[model samples]
Target chain A: MSDFMEQFAELRDQKRFQDIVDAIPYARLMGVELGEDESGELLFSLPFHERNVGNTVLPALHGGLIGGFLENAAMIHLIWNRESLDTPKIVDFSLDYLRSGRPKTLYASCEITKQGKRVAHVLIEAWQEDRSKPVAVARAHFLLATTS
Target chain B: MIATPVNPKVFEPMGQLFVSLPHCATLGFQYLGADGRKPVLKVDWREDLVGNPATGVVHGGIITSLVDTTSAVAVTAHLERFETIATLDLRIDYLKAATPGKAIYCRAECYRLASQVAFTRAVCYHDNPDDPIAHGVATFMRESSPLPMLQEPKA
Candidate 1:
């Protein structure tokens, strides 16, 4: 990890992290809260429920929601790194579905693949329980405001 | 819901009309709720068409499709006609996983819409309404086509 990334991990570990997501009303609506492990790793999980119902035949998850989860994961990871949201606006993002997220709670982790001065690139994966396996994967290109 | 067939001239932008799914044309989408310019849609997560990997968890592609489609829905809600809709950009944030046991419910809202593009926000929640498993924001470009086309899938 770079020195700046290392510093971010340190600050987040101390639990002084605060951002608009902490105060956003929808944060509670979406059941998304920020938590870090002792080793400074970030984890996001979503449990199964009734409201997610699609149909009696498939009973599958929505692709839009999966994309939402990935985007949030990437954004939160950026915030965790102490990057300003205004510095980056999503240029584009894409997701590939590998398999269905099983009936267990979904877990995700994101890595800042490349944090350039004008743009930041991120990669994220989501799966159920097992970190080694992934249900969906996504990449994000965030354009820094300073560049334009 | 209008059941007008899409014109081939406009549909040509998306290459071919792959799936003639009734859901997009006949049943159509109902605008349920919204906050300001943001509009929410209550869509049924069907198992047969959407898929069931295990017992209850729905496929993540459905959610991605919903977000992409709804961005257009927001545009349609404002424009009231099916033109070409292309996703300029999209980002999803996964919160809690999803409730695999039941259907996935979502409320997608469009927050900002301009001449070049429209901005949308959304959340997918199941079991508990207070918590959402996923959330998203996307930008869409209105084209003179049949439906919205997202960038080719990225795995």
Candidate 2:
């Protein structure tokens, strides 16, 4: 069987990828860019702007907004893999805030922890400026549309 | 048993089952559409709720919560009585920045309900409901246990 990364590359070239990206609301807000690395991993990035901040007084981004952004990133990765704009139902999600997302662009990457026929588990990490230092981490479980 | 608050002036019965929940308690959630098979909840904008200061844009989280809560309200309309609900999953697509300083509203409906789950669809707009600024679909799980305080005392 072809690996997920290889399939991802083939799907990106098919031009079906943009539709998946455009369907996400947070993607429009943050202006996301979806790309693939040499290893076939999906790369999602957004430029951090002043508007993303929760308290302009503190100049810190809201945790909820951060959650929304990361959730969209992970969801898009799943859609890209499946090659469909229809999304799986999110069963549950939990996020741990490591640090404040500040005045810089943000990048996120995700890995499928458990890919079940009914449920898919994913782990996502987000950071700004430096990849080595992660700002937040999330674990999400999605219930597939076809699953009973 | 502790009594649930009931004020006659506010609690006008919408039907045999539903009460028109107080909009004042909901904060700018007034603008209800005409009574019909599926009633709509409206939200008119006020300056205080903006999420970003630079453009006076309402925060995405506020919109998300509005969708979640209003969806639950629609579900409550169908219920025999109050039941607790927990958000299962919610997804929203931001179409474009809403026009600043203009009153925006939301139309939320609960379209699907299973034994354990309720599914909802909602659109947020300004002035015109036809033109939507954000669209959302979410699933909410009903809570099984009643609060201890609300439990009836054994005779």
Question: What Cα-based lDDT does every candidate model obtain?
Answer: 0.54, 0.57
User: Candidate 2 lDDT (Cα, whole model)?
Assistant: 0.57
Q: Please write out the lDDT profile of model 2 over residues A31-130, one tens digit for every residue.
A: 5667675797887776766555532333455444566667777766675666443345555556665666676777889988888777888899999888
Cα error, residue B43 of model 1, in Å, equals 11
User: lDDT tens string, model 1, A1-148?
Assistant: 2343344455666674443233322223334456665677777665664333221123444444556667667766776775453423455567765655455577777899998877889998888866677788889876656443
Instruction: Please give me the total number of clashing residue pairs in predicted model 1.
Output: 55
Model 1 interface CAPRI class: incorrect
Which 10 successive residues of model 1 chain B have the least lDDT summed? B11-20
For candidate 1, what's the RMSD? Answer: 14.5
Please estimate how well model 1 matches the true structure, expressed as its whole-model Cα lDDT. Answer: 0.54
Candidate 2's TM-score:
0.47
TM-score of each: 0.47, 0.47
lDDT of 2 by residue, B1-155 (tens): 52221322211232211212221222345536323323455545555454333446554544654555455555545554445554555666666667766665666666776889888787778767678887777776665334310222245
DockQ scores for all predicted structures: 0.08, 0.05
